[model samples]
Target: MDEALELGEYLPQSFANLNEQTYLDFLWSALRTNYEAERYEFASLAFHLLYMSFVSFSIWQIRLARPGQFAMAMVGFRSEEEGSLLDCESPFKFYDRLKESQIFRFLKLIGCNNEQVGEFAKFVRRRNKIAHPTGTVFFNDQAAIDEEIASMMKEVRNIEAHMQPVIRELYHRFLRDSADPEEREYTVLGDEITANFVHKNYMSAADIAFCQGFDIDALSGEPLHDAMKDLHDALVALYPAEGDVEEAA
Candidate 1:
């Protein structure tokens, strides 16, 4: 009872409607019937005993690959010579041997500091040690659990921060270049922007011609904060989001 109270003191139990639940929400609801947020338990499990982290990581990688662009995250985010190191089109090809595949390079390419990169590498090794099962006992106390989840999210945020400009550019180009209602057989682009992200059909048909049409380099000078703000403004102008979404993490 005391532990639960202490947890509540910090967590302040949040709730979401059925359709509005985020990934973390669903996780908590499944784990605890009360749906109290026992954060980092999943991260500890993910790194220590479960393969769920890899599945989540794949989703992030796909997001970074930018579905509507010709660019794959592995190659697109790199400098010309560095990208040429591996002549690959998709990151999926190298998922099996991620450690040896220069996964650390992705952090460096996205401009993570040396300290952050080193920390990420340390967590990767920790995950590996647990994965191999060497008759060694692994302790996942609450603090350690929190650290693992924090570390994973920190690196993800680092990449996302750097990507704001390019991503916003893609969104803008998607709205600007797509055909009007007269030619298309679906919802209008502006209205469809209210959906998860632009239109579903728009995401499916990512041709080289369409990719070549928009020059992502145009956003090179934009600051990360400005890019994110611009994207938000653009979205709100096209189709306003609810006030509740702003409260989300």
Candidate 2:
């Protein structure tokens, strides 16, 4: 079996062991509290629902972004023609390259395969439908929409549970396998410190750039901190550890 597959196989079991009841209870409580606050119970429910929906989407983006980086790293080159072999040459091609990459195949070993990708894409689409003003009237008995959201959340949690170990292993491998130890150490340390800053302080992108020693106002013209706050928060939440607790205290 390929190394990626072997690495990823334990994800399903990890996912299976997760107590989803905790998440369900949290969602229910959040929705119920919102309903109690205002007489417009449906609107309140919808608002909380919307919050959950966005949270789910944010989680998916983080999950995919890291893996996508790892996958890209494994591909070992970046050419238009080379990218085309994986069906991703065009800048417009979002799904094609992800579907055909060697990393995707490796991810399959641990069961973090394309099946999960399809579901995550669907989650993003449904969130957009609800969030966008498309003139369609939304009702409280939107059972189908709610079901889709719940299913997507379940899958997101499953993917997260499974990928943690693999991610750790990949990180170690990257550090150990780098040809230039000094550059590798710097890169790894930068990644670690950036992750730490985002997790502990929920810093803005500007703050992140500053922490990394970049010029404050040069790159994107606008203040990137606010825009990146949510992303930083989500990543920190996902990878919380003993140090995070100590820092919080």
All models, RMSD in angstroms? 10.8, 16.0
Q: Following a full C-alpha superposition, what root-mean-square deviation does model 2 have from the true structure?
A: 16.0
Q: What are the per-residue Cα lDDT tens digits for candidate 1 across 1-249? A: 122222221111121223322543444444344213443434344332212323223333334444433234456344753444344333333444344325554544445677765765566567666657588645435555555555555554454455444444455554443333343343544454434243321121122122233444464565443443443444455432333347542
List candidate 1 segments past 4 Å from native.
1-43, 47-101, 107-109, 113-116, 183-185, 194-249
Q: For candidate 2, lDDT tens digit of each residue in 104-169? A: 333343456587655545544554565677776443444543544356456545654555444444
Clashing pairs in 1: none
Model 2 segments more than 4 A misplaced: 1-109, 112-148, 174-248
Give the CA lDDT, 0 to 100, for residue 225 in model 1.
Answer: 37
Clashing pairs in 2: 5-109, 8-110, 9-110, 204-225, 205-225
Candidate achieving the largest lDDT? 1
